[model samples]
Target: MMRHLLPLLALLAAPAFAKPDADTRAWLARTAELSSDAMEGRDAGSPGHARAIDLVERWFKDARLQPAGEDGSFRQTVPLHEVAVTSAEMRVVAPDGSAVPLKFLHDITPRPATDLPATLGGAMRFAGYCSAKEIGAEAGPALQGKIAVCFGSRRTGRANGAERLAAVTAAGAIALLTIDDVGFLVEPPRWPDAYARSVAHDGVTLPSGLPQFRVNGAALATLIAGSGRLAAAILTDAGLHRDLESFDLPGRFEAKLTTSQRKFTSQQLIGLLPGTDPAKAGEYLLLGAHIDGYGFGEPVNGDALYNGTLDDAAYVALISQLAARRKGKGFARPLLFAAWTAEEKGLLGARWWLQHPTVPKDQLAGVINLDQLRPLFPLKALTLHGLGQNTLADTAKAVAEGLKIGIRPDLEPERNLIRRVDSWPFMEAGIPAVNFIFAFNPRSQEERLYRDWYVRRYHRPQDDMTTPMDLDAAQDFNRFFYLLVETAAHAPETPRLSPKPGT
Candidate 1:
């Protein structure tokens, strides 16, 4: 009895362990290589990212995937242009003529405009939520020549950033400053931004002259200090999405801005595995993950590299691992394995590919994008984007159920994350697509870890190899992904978007 009791106690004392298999171990090893500091965070259009592209191409070649890129090569050059803010200075001139300086990158960060002026300023006016619907009549002559200040919130039904920009721009405001919303805890704003930069495809133009800026939420009180309005009260109202009244501030905004521009190119690596069935060979399923990260940035906690391990490097490695496991074998439908670039710079690579697909657009059946697949805790359920909107949902559900993993629709729709990821472009093109997030029970340890990840390491250098990850969870998700790919690719009918009403 003593011997039996001793064994039971030992087992109970030690936590449950799920050992990673050889394949998962290999997958992580590859992830570490891609996200290593030596890769310089793999920023798009950087030398480091070019090196990563080569590595992925080599991996695909080793897996026996045929080149399906430009001119029968596994490389597609994505034309890109970048603008970096080298310097910026802003001041709030009080009615009495005293100026309060705003710290660059601390109190505010300017979005470098395509036609940014050397200097510009105007009287400041609060524009409530700044939505066209919200601003209604006030957006006309009332905002014609002044700078408009708006609250940035992700609360449901609130206009998104683009709509807000259009509303303020159309109102003839010279500039727009959006105060960061601190209420949104799903993904709170990070202060002292790494840098200020804008990237877009070559030849694409933006709304010129109307510069944009983001004000730190903590500094809102300072901006409204002498306006006779209580900052706390206004902030509380904004945080609660309460109706706010537009008002003129006690000061005029003065500013100086400087920027530098450069043009460079990036690569989108695409490899193909032809289908085994002659009939289904005409169709294809695309598997994609971004290979770019934040690259070099202002030092954070004495570190400056944003390795983007789980943000996408790991998932890119997972794709490579999948290729290796297949060893050149084809599914019922062809598989187009794509490693995208410039995703951090606003999904440029994927968007470009959508416009210039290596395979015929009509033959592309579905897209499965891997990004921000945080495996920080146990993988019990998956929060799927595009969950009931298409046939891909059924395949994902079946695959997840067979693995004993629960599947559910996104419960946090207010975040609007679906439109922010790489899969959005494909989904918008009318192709069925899906993305995933590891789900956790509220108020649980897993929830704590998940939320903490966003605050401490989401886009920071802290997301390096040293960051803690649940190996068991990683392995489980890897298995689920591998099976999901197989199940989706082998299904008799290719995935398609669910029919809409009146279609």
Candidate 2:
């Protein structure tokens, strides 16, 4: 009898095939439509993004969601200013009076400064990781009038990006050159960027730091040729966070930089799904996903369009599908569906919405952000960003367990991925919020797929719809998210922030 029941139980479990169900099919169809080349990668403030907005507004209307944006409209305009580098040229002036021209995007990609100079030149000085401790007391005199080259990798015990900047700036460096770390297999460096650009909220002041650049790993050899240090050894040591000595390279770093500036406006789509119970209707839960991608840039394998199929377009479609499924029904608390813009430029869209909320900020009970989720493999587990930091974790775990999916806190905290997504703004505002990443076992094929996606497709034109996807995995995650939202929205008590230390 027990053996017979075991077989029956297996039949009742969710299928593990690669085919998608009707619901997943619809969600994927929407994703394909939004991430197609016709959408021009949906860059924020671009015509492509405008079309995306129109499509989403229609979806919201069809789903019976109420207009909950500015002045009762389903759209909230966000003003933004953009700066793009039009031309860049760098050359190495070797001590022996030889000049070698470095390819712009191939050899190095410079971060365009707000107050960019037409030309920059300085002697080359390497300061290992450029950490405060490594720079030492004489850093000021050592790096002055030189271009400080540092290892670019954020590690557990090393000084972070901001600290490195302060240290180098205080040392009077004319500019900074950071060799991109190659050992971070999770997200390796991919050279030949589409373009260098920056976007900021309109009327906001942009930082005027020293002009900085990322040197391609292959180009490191050229930068350190006469320093008597092997580029491979330097990168190997840097990857392990080992201490390295500082030295001046036998070259003068020179560059010519040119940029174009423009100002434009983007809009965030906001809609409200009303609740059935009047008592809990006053409280709200927000579900958000960014709908922007890198519009166009330098071509890769002859494709210049950066179709962000999974980066976020797929998740945006997921939220739309959720709204459509709950079209005629209601949870206890109202649900806010947000299609954020300019997420690629920073968390500008979400940040702006937080600053100018459509509903009372205090009424927002919790948030579930959908981004950085990759269903390349079976959805056996999930990595929750704010797992132990909020009360939402319990609800999320309960829902996930019902679907047989394991829930765990971030396993890669060194990446600081938790604070990099849109939910962070809500978390900062004392609201319970959570974001997710599909988990994979160490040394498993699933891990390979996950890491490969980050290396080959992430933030690249190769992230188009042609990439293979595990439809079953996608469907499982979809179901899990839908149930999670339903559980949170119907809970008798609203989710609250966990108590902070000393509180």
* Collision pairs in model 2: 194-298
Q: For each candidate, what is the lDDT?
A: 0.86, 0.85
Estimate, for each residue in 346-412, the C-alpha lDDT of model 1 and write its tens digit.
9999999988988898899899999868988889999888787899978998899899999988888
Off by over 4 Å in 1: 1-18, 133-142, 501-503
Q: What TM-score would you give candidate 2 relative to the actual structure?
A: 0.95
For every model in order, what is the number of clashing pairs? 0, 1
Please list all clashing residue pairs in model 1, or write none if there are none.
none
Taking the tens digit of each residue's C-alpha lDDT, what string does model 2 give over 1-503?
A: 23223432342243654345779878877887788777788999989889989988899999999999999899999999887778998999898989888789888988875797889998988888888777765566899889999888767777777878888988889898988878776677887887888889998866567888888888988888788889999888888878877888998889999988888999989999988889997789999999998888888888888889888999899999999998857788899999999998889999999889999999999999999998888899999887778878789988998889999888888777988889988898988999999998889999999988988898898886666677778889998999999899989888977776888
Off by over 4 Å in 2: 1-19, 501-503
